[model samples]
Target: MTLAKGCTLCYQGAKMVLFVTGRCRRSCWYCPLSSERKGKDVVFANERRIEAPEEAVSLAERMSALGTGITGGEPLLCIDRVNEYSKALKDHFGKEHHIHLYTAQAPTKPELEQLAGLVDEIRLHPPRECWDHITDTDYIASAKNAKEMGFDIGIEVPALPGLELLIPALPYLDFLNINELEWGETNAGEMRERGHELADGVHNAVSGARDWADELLNHGKVHWCASSFKDSVQLRERLKRIAENTARPFDEVTDDGTIVYGVLDLHPGTRDAVVARCRTFLTEDEFSDCGDRVETAWWLLEEYRDRIPGKKSVVERYPDGGMVVEVTPL
Candidate 1:
């Protein structure tokens, strides 16, 4: 089956996740947003929080994004921000830079009109309750109207038991994405109370999620996104893209997409001596004196472990100074 334009970019690790805001009006039982963003008002381009559209543009450029997927608690809730960032990305990246947006709310004609040229695709989320009676809701009109205005329209929802109920609404959509439902920090208690469990111990996917939507796999427009694929493949590919664009000369980009480098935690008296020693043995590009610590290639530190007079270790972390993944003491 052909993937939607946005999904195609995402599968290639060429799509940036532009999180506009975390404020939403509805509380769906399966909402997997993390506690840090579930109800908070914040914006993030990938993992970096930002205060301006320019920041999002910069982040997108770093990873050479071919497209962007604007998402949030409900992006429509902050229409102004959505429009601003979408315009900024398109403006900087050119008209060919595709953009797709996800909104739980059924946008009115005015809202759809506002997003006309800025967004190329719209994925509607009609809430599970409205799936069986989608024709009776505003989503049908929204999808039809969006299509008329040049937007590729589709419906995306977490895989749930009543998925078949959405069959009647498929004709109004360009595609239907069935995302593997998974547990989240904010929804774990609720999921447990509802008797939901992980499909396996290693993945966050809900049990029976794929089986619920298995019958629709043969449909040409149906795309199934497994939770494990999102957690591993998607995330790893995205990280690899970022690491390719941002890794330092001394950093070793690992197969898993994390960068590994040597670090020397400087002591008050040994800071200068350590910096001086690093300069003598390492070229200017090979070592960096980052205030309280000195950084170099992990192999260099491993060879000169006895020569440096400070706490030494090798760290593997996400690119662009993201979260630390591992630290091995030397």
Candidate 2:
């Protein structure tokens, strides 16, 4: 399948996201980090806060990840931490497990050399001011250094007006990724200050952001990632991959990668009786005890809802992590 250049693993739902640290050197006005993570020096594996490297590896295993993408406020700032985690992942998953990192800093030769040993790809995000004349910035030297070191070097930047100037650096890069500029809870005020408004009916993306991608298509190795694709495709595919591995037998995996099941809330007084009656109706493999409630196939609960004693509802949750998406009463 033809995937976006330099984003093949992400497109295939085989890349685990490793958020190393949220500390960065530069403050970009359009940064979309959530308030909890924006300036905090926290680490996360997907949405789960992590305190140890083993947790990251366990998450990758949960989703059967073929590779990892390390990102942060600036990964190079915690070079030792990056090296430690990258090596830990490589050691656990083997050298064939591809690892890529995103950084805003223009790293030095020695820094690049150390990173190159653990990473398969390096995507640099130069500051927005340098987008108008990228070749003149210090990024050019860093890109060249990374390329000479045999890393798959690329540039990734939000698609904004005047980004076409980056075409000059293409000869030195293996690819260029243009991400549709987005609005978020943390950046909404700043985005509006920059004269950006949300597109009609769209939730978090700026208007006219896509047009910038269109303007850069004629340049070779340019990949424009639409905001819709990230929500509707990349995320859903990753959820499906995780669901296939983690979903309980009683849960149904929906086409959109949400887990659908029935939950019967149990009170302390009736818990044992209700569970015993439920067991008689459902096969052992078709139901599971979930501490606060019992989960079973939605249809089965729907058919037997009136007979059961406790409040009954069908629940839908994101497959990768158990975040509720929807709940419906019988």
Candidate 3:
């Protein structure tokens, strides 16, 4: 059921936890989202925003979102906006809609009570340095509060290299999800300042991040899902969820920004089909990833779906407005 990477609602496709407000009360060095996007509560999920609550509901439905994980510079700051978005989604969709959120700010009794009606689950990201500061008293207090509200609460954090010292105290939290820490262009400067380096292979799941995840999983106090978590676990679980929750035909684009269907390699064809397709499904206004104006014909796809006698192909469109099909000749 996984549509594809970057596809809406697809696991690994668009786990766009809205970094609502970049403004955070605490400053962690490993903040990969970086400083530029902080406190700008304009609303963004994986570089895109649905804007209005009405539009967001429909947009999320179209993208086949199983659950909307509302995060933020700190979700609590914009709890009102997040609550609006969450409730709107449930209204457009239904109670079955799986809605989750991330936060560090422990909510008050009133906030928790209000959030209970909207969110299905919540994950907390307390800094690794702050792990010791959090104890059964504070951590469990928040967890119990959310749990009482019938929310599946858990903890998420980057697998900072040397945090095994804190692993033995797993009974403190019901579920702990460890993200393989990685550096991105947005946070490169901060990472360098913090003396973090990128690993040679992406599969390695950040340099020290993997090492910590392995260490945590061994104890079994909490379920420590790794970065290379199985495709069935990583992609299928949530995608199947989103797919089952909403209905939207997918149009996957490639890194080159071309769409493919049936291996037509329309990279060399008339722009008619491409333009028609986008105008029909994506939008009436023409758009191109090549930075060329919509009217520019020079970059018209010159590719086409290859046809062979006595063979069939699986047609797919690339994100770049081109086509691809996998088939066998018999």
The per-candidate count of clashes, in order, stands at 0, 0, 47
Residues 84-130, model 2: lDDT tens digits: 98999999999888999999988789998788779988889998787
Model 3 lowest lDDT segment of ten: 296-305
lDDT (CA) for every model shown?
0.92, 0.86, 0.55
TM-score of 2: 0.96
TM agreement with the true structure for every prediction: 0.98, 0.96, 0.66
Arranged by lDDT with the best first, the candidates are 1, 2, 3
lDDT for each residue of candidate 1 in 1-330, tens digit (9 for 90 to 100): 889999998988889999998999999998999988888899999999899999999999888899999999999999999999999999999999999999999999999989989999999998988877888899999998998889999999999998988888889999999999999898999999989998899989999889999888889999999988887888888889999999999999998889999999998877888798888889999988899999999999999988878888999999989999999998
Off by over 4 Å in 1: none
- Model 1, residue 44: what's the lDDT? 92
TM-score winner among the candidates?
A: 1
List where candidate 2 sits over 4 angstroms from the true fold: 1-6
lDDT for 106 (candidate 1): 94
State the lDDT at 130 in candidate 2.
79
Candidate 2 achieves a global lDDT of 0.86
